[model samples]
Target: MDVLEAIVLVNDMVVDSSSRRNDAWPELDDLSAISSSFYRDTDIAEGYGDSALEMELYRLSIEKTRNLVSSGDLQRQLGFLPSMREIEVLPVIYRDRADFVEKILDSIRSSPKNAGISTELHRQLNGFTQSLNVLPDALQNFALFAFRGFYYQELAHLTSASYMPHSWRSGIIRSQLNRSVSRFADVAIGAGEKVRSKLQAAINDEFGAQVISANFPLIASFVIGQASRRSDLLRTAVEIRDSAKATAFRAWVYEMERRIRNEQDLDKVKQAQDELTTLVRELEVDLGLQRKPTQEMTLTLALPLPLTPSIERTLHVSSPAWVRRVLRRRTHLVFLRELAQESISLPPFVRSYQMLKL
Candidate 1:
């Protein structure tokens, strides 16, 4: 028999053996049994010929096994396989550029702080790198930027709390970040002379290199813009700074308001309010719309207002009681808004107060 026929015969033998066992499914142990039987059968061995055919058979067998497992038939038969919910394995295959980009972003967003890339994401990146030459220029640049961005963000999280007391775990995390940054830089530098020059110009010293590596996404965007002559792709330092500031302001305001709304303790609510007010003032000053005052003070008031509900009531009410509850909440919100507006003098604060209106 030829190689194809021999492989078919082997599969038939395996299936026949499984049927003999009261129609039971084949187990991993069946592989060994089938292998021994194949070697013991002189006719089949002579029919296939040579060590080359043996190797071919081995390779095809492995390929066939993978196909079976991937197709879910073998998976269904094997009770040992983990359930989808218990152990999710994201497929590394990408259908198109959009799918690839979405997967990268989703992985980065869902990854835990300081945990670095997941195995599936790493596999996807490796595949992208291996096929980089065949990929479209736009996709190539995006993939590289995403790879660098993920590591940089991880490094930022690792080093953001450097002021805290160092421990063995922290040291390990820092070491990993350093290695990741260095490896990424080396890869980028090896891409081409132009990339190397850009990276080197930004990196004057070891410390500067670390800083640049940690912010490589911004630099990469600029470099890609220059290379492709696309002004829209360029991200200046000022733009990055403003974007970061806006994001931070929004996040801080949301967190503070969430604390104010959820907090049952009066002291904590007052503290959250004070913190929010200070944040608004700081943001205003940062935007160059206001000057810093020489003296900063926070005023606390003891009011007879009842505690706000932890859960916000919807505006669309069908009952009179719900209407009264909504009106009462609106009154408290208006009082808070007027109080904050009297102290803060910026249109930004007006937006922030509106968020408090819930």
Candidate 2:
């Protein structure tokens, strides 16, 4: 088959998985089987090569080959599934390490213009990924299932490290390690038994039918729910890591929130500020990947709260202290000028019950 045909088939795979309406979930189960079958005899990857349970792998190879090629045609037949691009490519690199490095350097040298732009590119394979996401449905479907196979391989390498055959495989596996490095409160919450139990109990207590919606499936929603708790946990982490004044943390959070809210494309840059500002002098470190954060960092996944809807139904809303602080910050206080508005409690929902002074 021509490269074009191969690309089209990959699109078929991607569309089958990621798109919500696609009736192709079964195909995904098959792709994992395909990956297994492809390596049934390949003993290079240790535990990565057991083919007994790989029914889908056999189906995938047969289906892809039969659909793409005539029964007898063979042009070295060296196509690797896009999802296995990194895995396949890395093995080639390991086999020809010097040649791989030389080619990579040569590519870099040829793309001088890309050097600066690439420096700011946070994700590896970002361009390739963006292009793939916009492909035909068949290719998309293929990719979705294929890449998941790579993840499975990575997971295997981790929990059972003695079987790991190569250091290159360690790259993707490090994400599991990155989980520890991740400062996201949500990650911690999802991984913690106590947090999950609490979150589950809270949802059962409040929604009666689990506040999780279809858009955010149950486990996924729970993961993201912890993200809602970030600001709260961020406060605690910053305090622990930096041992700073509470007001300092508040100021930092305000600045972070503002930067995210106001940032826009360069076209939106109304004025170019001078780079040699007093602020730049104060921040001696550059905002690059090589620069480590000054504060101690740890992944402290936010614990889920048994939040009732009356508390405003959003992240960080459960904390009364936050409400008071937010009011004090006056991110908005337009109504304060009115007599009735001024008379209202800070959050508008603060209890009106009065207490006698001792």
How many Å off is the CA of 70 in candidate 2? 20
Segments in model 1 whose C-alpha atoms lie over 4 Å from true places: 1-128, 161-358
lDDT of 2 by residue, 203-304 (tens): 567877765321111222222222324323222222222222223333433343344346743332222111112112212222221222233334344436
Q: TM-scores for all candidates? A: 0.18, 0.18
Q: In candidate 2, where is summed lDDT lowest over 10 consecutive residues? A: 347-356
What lDDT is reached at residue 128 by model 1?
46
Q: Which candidate has the highest lDDT of all?
A: 1
| lDDT of every model, 2 decimals | 0.32, 0.28
The residue-by-residue lDDT of candidate 1 on 69-146, one tens digit each, is 344433333223223231222223222445554543343333254134344444544444555555444334333433
TM-score, cand. 1: 0.18
